[model samples]
Target: MRFVSFRSGADEARLGVLEESRIHVLHPGSTLLGLLGDDGERLHEAGAAALRDPYDVLDLDETRLLPAVPAPPTVRDFMTFERHVEGTAKLAGPDGRVPAEWYEFPTFYFTNPYAVIGPHDDVPVPPGCTLFDLELEVAAVIGREGRDVRAEDAAGHIAGFCLLNDWSARDLQLTEMQIRLGPAKGKDTSLSLGGVFVTADELAPHRSGTAYDLEMTATINGEVLGTDKWSSMHFSYEEMVAHASRGTVVRPGDVLGSGTSGGGCLAELWGREGFDAHAPLGPGDVVTIAVEGLDSMTSRIVAYSDRGR
Candidate 1:
């Protein structure tokens, strides 16, 4: 089932199951987080019930979509794709390859959950960032709480998956990384997710062991920029979860991003080509990212206009 968090009939947020061009409201006060309270089975059942009962149906055009798990408990983004890592390293200098330690375990960074936006939202270009870029990735939403989870048992902890666009300020990020402890201001600005939340059970047919055999693609202003398969990730979501849960607890609604795929961002493309050959995102550029079996998310880029800033 495809779930969507949306505002309807007076801007009240609600959970709904999307079908065709209509959404069936599952509950009046239920939210995405509330729905994921316990491994998401109840939410799945509610969605199934709504589909059968055809209750409180609303047209998709009349509802404003929100992030699948608006205000997630925590957001951990992992660098699981070797192609992305290798491509990014090449930009630093010659003979750059995946770091040796990177092979030892899944590495991730915590990002600001407050900065999340939904599909079709306008992402303001952060002030002073001329090298804005979009990262195409997939994120797994945790369904159960666990500490020190094992890789073999991590699969059951995933509630669902959604398309994620990790908006970036390349200029700021590059500078921060050089100084050794940042990626902060550069990433804190905005992150876009969800046009739809697809439950793990719904995607079982596409599963390839620990990974999904789904196509991931990104386009800007109708031009294809990145395209890859979800199967390309070197580390699986299970590995990421196990690693993240090493000495901490992971709860439901916590999001784990698969990081950027190969050629998934301008920085990688620039490394593969040249900075002069590509342009940064500016006002009015539309970025669309899609994963097979999941709804696509489209965000429009706008210039920052806070006169006070």
Candidate 2:
């Protein structure tokens, strides 16, 4: 089942199950993560009950949606797409090359969960950011707690998936990387996630060998930027989760980003093409991403300014 978190009128953020263009509101003040924290069977029953006798129903377009997990406990973005890594290397300069270790295991970095924002929310362009860019990918939310999980058993711990846009400030990121670290300031400005969460069962039809074979695409200001299939990831979500669990606890509401798919971000495009070939994101640009079953997400670019400015 698909679920969404939204706020309407004077009410606080609330969870709801999506039924077509309408939302069957769940508890009056519950959160999406709170529901995910519950037992799977109980959550299903609650959703079913909500659908049958919704205390409130609202048109999907009428509410302001929040991120799928709203405030995830933690966020880890993995570099699982080999092609994207290779392509981005060219943009990294002459000595740029994909590290051999990347092929050995799925590598990831923790990102600020507080920076998370929903699809329809405006992404603020950080001050001094000139080469603002967007990374289009998929994100999974952890449902059950686990540690030292095996790849074969990791799938059960995932709650759902959603589209993720990892916004970046290329120049800042590049400068930091030159010192052998960081994608931090460049990335922490915002992390856009689709408000709608598609359960694993709902996307089972798109499952391929290890990853889903869903078609993912992104556009800027109505112009198509890139498109790729989720099946291209070298490491599966299961593998990534298993790797993440090595000597560490994976908790419910923690989000796992699939990293940028091949051709999914302008940085990769710049490497494949040339730096001068494309323009960076600027104020007023709208970035929209869509996956086969997960609903689309659109975010407008805005600048940090005074309240009345």
The Cα local distance difference test for each model comes to 0.87, 0.86
lDDT of 2 by residue, 173-274 (tens): 988878877777988778888989888888988899768888888899999988888899999999989999999999989999999988788898888788
TM-score of each: 0.96, 0.96
| Candidate 2 local Cα displacement, residue 92, angstroms | 2.7
Candidate 1 residue pairs in clash (backbone atoms < 3 Å): none
Which number leads on lDDT? Answer: 1
lDDT of 1: 0.87
- Candidate 2: list runs displaced more than 4 Å: 306-309
Write one digit per residue (lDDT tens) for candidate 1, span 1-309: 888989875867888899988998875787777766676778888888889885589999998998988888899999988889988887787577889999899899999999998886789898789999999989999988999999999988999988889999999999999889978989998988887888888888888855789888989998999888898888999999999999999999999999999878898887767788589999889888888777788888888783112
RMSD each, Å:
1.9, 1.6
lDDT at 235, model 1 = 92
